[model samples]
Target: MTQDSRQSVYERITATIAAAIEAGAGDFRMPWHTDGTMSAHPVNITTGKPYRGINTIALWAAAQGAGYGSAIWGTYRQWAACGAQVRRGEKAALVVFWKIDEREEDAGDMDDGQSDPRRRVLARGYPVFNAAQVEGYTPPPLPALPASARIAHAERFFAALGVTVREGGTRACYIPARDEIRLPPFAAFRDPIAYYATLAHEATHWTGHPDRCARELKGRFGSESYAAEELVAELGAAYLCADLGLACEPRPDHAAYVASWLTVLRNDARAIFTAAAQAQRAADWMHARQPFAA
Candidate 1:
């Protein structure tokens, strides 16, 4: 791929997500939010691994737009390798990967006779088709855990993070000064999913503390930095929920942030890419705390 390939990948993914956000703006829905059909995170059917970073968001947006019930996806050849064929005329979605370009260069001011090796990582786009667009293959069945078990699992997950979370508040937020998370009692939420989802959001914020991911969360209200942080937390929560096999729902209070997010994306084509990468880091940080984390 050429230099233009990198910009096109970012622009294409950004435009897809921006369009999904705009389509859902009226209902306060986000591209990341999962309806029950999309209960699972986007995964590569061949690799059986969840997509990460911008790929996850980009595929989710594609699934949401196309009403794909399955979260599994793969390259056209991958599907064929799995004994499935993409249906006629089915279009593919874009995902990106970084390719390293390594070269030996003159080492300036170095006594070593050997030239130093220089490496440049470039973003390259790959097209993948959803399982829903294929025939003769099936995604593995999702486990059906009881509600109590699911909540217990979430509790254990949060406890493992070791973040100081204080229950009993009218709103949920991460207090950067205190380096703690605050949320209303679990009973305050409409359901277990809502409670855990809210916790995930705040936990993402907690990951951004100066000692952690170091995102700028102390910016003035309505500032671009503040809004970007919110966007990161939102995407982080969605990613975490998907990984945990929970359906993420859009928070009603966060509707106001959508306009700001759109503004950010419109102002900078790479905004979504940066936000998704930051969100992935936040989610990975939380996952690393899990006892069974790979």
Candidate 2:
């Protein structure tokens, strides 16, 4: 893709998310908040792989805007390869690919940096249609786990990570100096899902410690960077909730950060992309701790 096209991809996706966030400001609903009907994570029907980073945010915003309950998505040719056809007038949503350009000059394995050309990561956008937008392809629906099972699974997930989590706190947060998460008692939450949702948010923050994802966590408080970090945690929590089959709800305290997030997005079109990528990394790090993770 040309440099202009790459920039357009970032701008386009960022604008979509910013618009969605603005639209939801009235009720604090984010594009990532799922109502238990639609899957939180967007997956490609043909590849059966979940989209990551900005692609996930773009698809989530598209799905939320279009009321698409099905998380399955695929490119035009991908759908065709699966014997599925997009509806004649259905609109396609945009996703991106970051490919590395590997043109280089041989340096003969020497330590001289001047011998090799630096590779560039290029961005390319592709249009995709959701399962609801296509014909002749019906994905098998997975049954939702019971509430008890869902909570049990979440407990085990956190246990596997083995992060120090102390309950019985009024405010839920991750203390960087201590490298631990503090959360209110489970009973303090309105429901079980809310408890886990808050934990997911804090766990995302926990990953930013120097020993983990190593994000700028030490002195970014009350600044744009802090808001950006909050956005990362929010996105990370939503991703985890979706992957864990839990319905995500907006935390009441997070409403205040929406304005800051919008400011960040407005100032930098790539802010959402950066936050989503960092959020994905944090979520991936947590997932890596799972016993079943490959």
RMSD of each: 6.6, 5.6
Q: Write the per-residue lDDT of candidate 1 for residues 28-96, one digit (tens) a residue.
A: 888899843334678888778778878888898999899988889999999999999999999999987
The lDDT leader among the candidates is: 2
Model 2 lDDT tens row, 57-147: 7888998888888899999999999999999999999987755455321111111111134655666678999999989997887776687
- Model 2 Cα displacement at 252 (Å)? 1.6
Lowest summed lDDT over 10 consecutive residues: which window, candidate 1?
106-115
Candidate 1 achieves a global lDDT of 0.80
Model 2 misplaced regions, further than 4 Å: 36-38, 101-117, 217-222
Q: lDDT of model 1 at residue 94?
A: 91
**Backbone clashes in each candidate structure, one number apiece?**
0, 0
TM-score of model 1 vs. true structure? 0.89
